[model samples]
Target chain A: MKKRGIGIGSIFYGTGYGNGFPDVSKAVAQLKSDGKIAIYVGATEVGQGAKTALSQIAAEVLGLSVDDIVFINEDTSITPDSGTAAASRQTYNTGNAIKLACEKLKRDILEVAKDYLGLNSIVGLTLKNGYVYPKTLPEKRVSLGEISESLESSLKEEAVFTAQTTEMDEETGQGAPYWPYTFSACGVEVEVDTETGRVEIIRAVLAQDVGRAINPELIEGQIDGGFAMGAGYALYEDLKIEKGKIKNNSFTNYLIPTSLDMPDIEKVIIEDPESTAPYGAKGIGEPVMIPVAPAILNAIYDAVGVRMTEIPVTPEKLLKAIKEKEMTYNEGKN
Target chain B: MKKIKLTVNKKEYMLEIKEDTRLIDLLRDVLGFTGVKEGCGEGECGACTVIMDGDIVNSCLVLAFQADGKEIITIEGVESEEEIHPIQQAFLDVGAVQCGFCTPGMILSAKALLDKNPSPTREEIRAAISGNLCRCTGYNKIVDAIERAALYLKRGK
Candidate 1:
């Protein structure tokens, strides 16, 4: 017989560096000859799709297609200082910087258009689809490429965004440590074999509040990857060490969840936009993993009534715990 | 050092290498097929999975001498100059490629499975790529890509 149970876990993760400032800078430049926009930021894409997401933000601001925005990122010499890709700050920090830079570039384009078109007032001018036009009069419009070809200089602008966070009090250890916090809840279903103490996760449903999802597909990918790592942490992965030396350093010994080990995952995204963030987007990278382990652990306890505190809840430990719990119950009855 | 002749990616090559050289090193270093990544020198991660005589084998575990006369296929072999393979397209369509470290190996494993069984169940697909470890995407999209690739193959797309 198989015993199945379900459990839930929730978490609140603070974005940006904890108790420290996070900075992001972006530069937007238009090619003088081709009028193509290039965005430069030092944000690394370690499978979180930072490049695609930030490019989307720039495209939204510049009124250009995402394909038209060329990203020059992760190169220190070329791109400005966008801090490390940790603490889930790229989407919020770098995104805002890119937005600001694009906004500045748009202003520069309008300034150039006002002078070139010989218009007295640039009130109703708007940038749309690589063209500048008056809101009411579409005929009196000029292609951005034409403006660039006519101008002697290219359009270039840069902006920096620094996230503000209060330092933790030395005596009280309490203060606003980060800019924004992302909250998430995960529910897991599991099956426990009482004889072997093996716990198999059957399904996982994660509900995350990501101020806004710039790309829903990318968000789902992050969530799914995070859940796999979380599942490995809960039941399969163990880094053995002996006398301060590492053991089980190879993949064969240090087990990660394989395709066979993963369970069905359901994602529920809740959008609670952040006013300060670009496109009202917050970070979802780290928050997706926070609740997974606890949810699986809770499911295991619900199934077999064993409180597993250690990670990698291996068969030996779980079996021992189960036996100990049964013995304690029998002793009390006797 | 020994002289060995093998067919790789439908091209034949005669090379001089040490008997102990691993197939992964031969493919990546000697032949410049850098698509074959080595995550673990051991056979566990399956990051170096390649097709050898119509079956998937971990390239890191196979000695170069043992590969003599055996036809080998790496990720580079899966696509032509004009178009990518149906499996590669399926991976892209299903959003399976992420960090892409595990993509080449995972695709080869799927290829091996699909070559043997054009119509595989979800569980069979999972079991086929069980040896391949991907730190990104949680294997869900990869599985989806494989299933979609199977459909494409069945429809002769």
Candidate 2:
């Protein structure tokens, strides 16, 4: 692992689409020829499963299973220039790139299938378990190995596809729609300790409008993970920043949500598949985090009569607020 | 450096290490169990949590020597060969993993709770993992996964 692998340099291509990019196909072919493998582009799985999503995209497009895909995403030299894993764009953007490559491979295979099977159009060909079959003739199938051999015999169609997306404006922060967005709504119920200023999440319902449920189980996992992160942001987690340096860099000062802190979460995956996505799937990376803080805040307000607007709503803060409310009530009586 | 032996996930390891080395480091760097990660490297975040003698303790705070001669269980030791441990499987099935960085620790925390009390109320499960901070999915699904796993474990499956 390179020391700079997780640095800011790996995140932005430029400002938007063509920012930190590489000659994708050339890199892939060259890497393969050199016995180098395609590392799944992005940061390590650190809990977001960027690698899994990337593999799903490649497999769906290449007409292969996720097991066949091996990624070496940690290295800088061998992989495509995948920006950061933040904001959930790995699947949204990188998946599309792999999907595009897969589509190309599929088209080329269909042409071979068309010529060999005496068919004119490749429109109705569907990929099933690495085999191509026409809807009318589901029983008739051509193995991917056969197509691979045919392609290898004819042309070296071994290349990777690269994509570029634009960013927000430098000054105005307004630009063409930045990459597609993933959306979700978090509904939460909390119980506040009237005495201790502790906020307990009793129950939570996360309704995510993911462009597609590429992997339903994984999608839920993303939401669950986000919920914990968000809950921490709301009730417990705080990075105490003084100037720009973190004062509470250690865990002792910065409080995070524990299992005792969370409520029962019912993850609702609303799949509104995006055609722009590899398989109608949009990235759920940041969206899961986006709504969590607000949801927990709302729940806290609902739980307690006092509407505490600030974060980490520590017991001390809550106690002060309660006292202030009492003082205000006494003054009103006078 | 004093030599110490510890049983981790049913396996024994002997090491000669400094006093300041954290159990989290010992597990990941020394033991080659990268599944246990350091999110906060402090006790506030349960990302370094592991089961020690059937209770959940943040591996970050436990000194390497303190963990010495104790029976410890990391995420890698949670499951048998044929199937995922109940907590792990429930996490997957319930969508409890997103980035999966905090997963091993969170699962281990849940395991600790279930081991002590096989049938935990929802509140108990939440209290169990409150130390773990996940930045991706919210704690809703994680709690759900724990509840589901508790049921399965209680059923003896």
List clash counts for every candidate, in order.
0, 45
lDDT of candidate 1 over A1-334, digit per residue (tens): 4688899999998998868654544555554467678888889998889999999998898788987888888888887788899889999998998898888888888888888777877788988888898887878888888888987777788888888788899999999998888899999999988888888899989999999989998888888999999999999989888999888888767888999889879999999999999989999998999899999999989998888999989888889998999999999999
lDDT of 2 by residue, A92-189 (tens): 66666666555665676677777767776888987767677888997777766666555534322333444445555678866643545455677766
lDDT of 2 at B18: 89
Candidate DockQ scores, in order: 0.81, 0.53
Give per-model TM-scores. 0.96, 0.75
Which digits, one per residue and each the tens of the lDDT, describe model 1 over residues B1-157? 9999999999999999998899999999989999998988788888899999999999999999999999999999999889999999999998888899989999999999999999999899999999999998999989989999999988984
Q: State each model's CA lDDT, in order.
A: 0.89, 0.68
Best by TM-score: 1
lDDT of 2 by residue, B3-115 (tens): 89999999988899988888888899988988888876657777788888888898888999998779999988988989888788888777776666788888888888888
Chain B TM-score, candidates in order:
0.97, 0.94
Poorest lDDT segment (10 consecutive residues) of candidate 2 chain B: B131-140
